[model samples]
Target: MVTRDDFTEERIKKLEKNLLKVRKENRVKEIANKMHEVLSGKIISVDMNPCYLNDLSYMIKKNLELVREALKKNVSDEGSTSNVP
Candidate 1:
């Protein structure tokens, strides 16, 4: 079960802000909804340490890149054609 203690208030607030933006604009809302529906999402798992904010920049950058890649893939039809299996 997920609890409030499991997430930071700042993180929750940021999610709320994103949701607000999603609700406010048609294009953004559509894209946000699509990203949520598709295999594109952020994974912000904070550390238990109280002073871990300084270490979050790398994680934030990684997640941002994922979001960007997802956007590019979503906007284009020229996708991967084969699996390297």
Candidate 2:
């Protein structure tokens, strides 16, 4: 009972859905790359010094906060394109 036009329409719909999926995947990869770039750094020496420990802890917390903000911004930017859960 399927006509040629119907078949073509179905194919087009499938392709559009696939394109959207690919776009969403690309967006995720972009976000991940940005996060990696933000977090990448030289390895620091570890010692028993309390000051060093405090500085390391602060750096980690700051990096995590930056990542969170970046993710939030990305999610908001893509709000119309995809649903972020």
Candidate with maximal TM-score = 2
Residue 50 alpha-carbon offset, candidate 1, angstroms: 11
- Cα lDDT tens digits, model 2, 1-85, are 9999999999999999999999978865654554455458634445546754564466567778998999999888888575556
Name the regions of candidate 2 deviating beyond 4 angstroms: 41-85
Candidate 1 accuracy as lDDT: 0.59
lDDT of 1 by residue, 1-85 (tens): 6567766776889999998887657644444443444335555345534333333444455668998999998767446554457
* Candidate 1: residue pairs that collide: none
* Candidate 2 weakest lDDT stretch, 10 residues: 30-39
What is the lDDT for 65 in model 2? 96
lDDT of 1 at 51: 38
TM-score, model 1 to reference:
0.30
Q: How many clashing residue pairs are found in candidate 1? A: 0
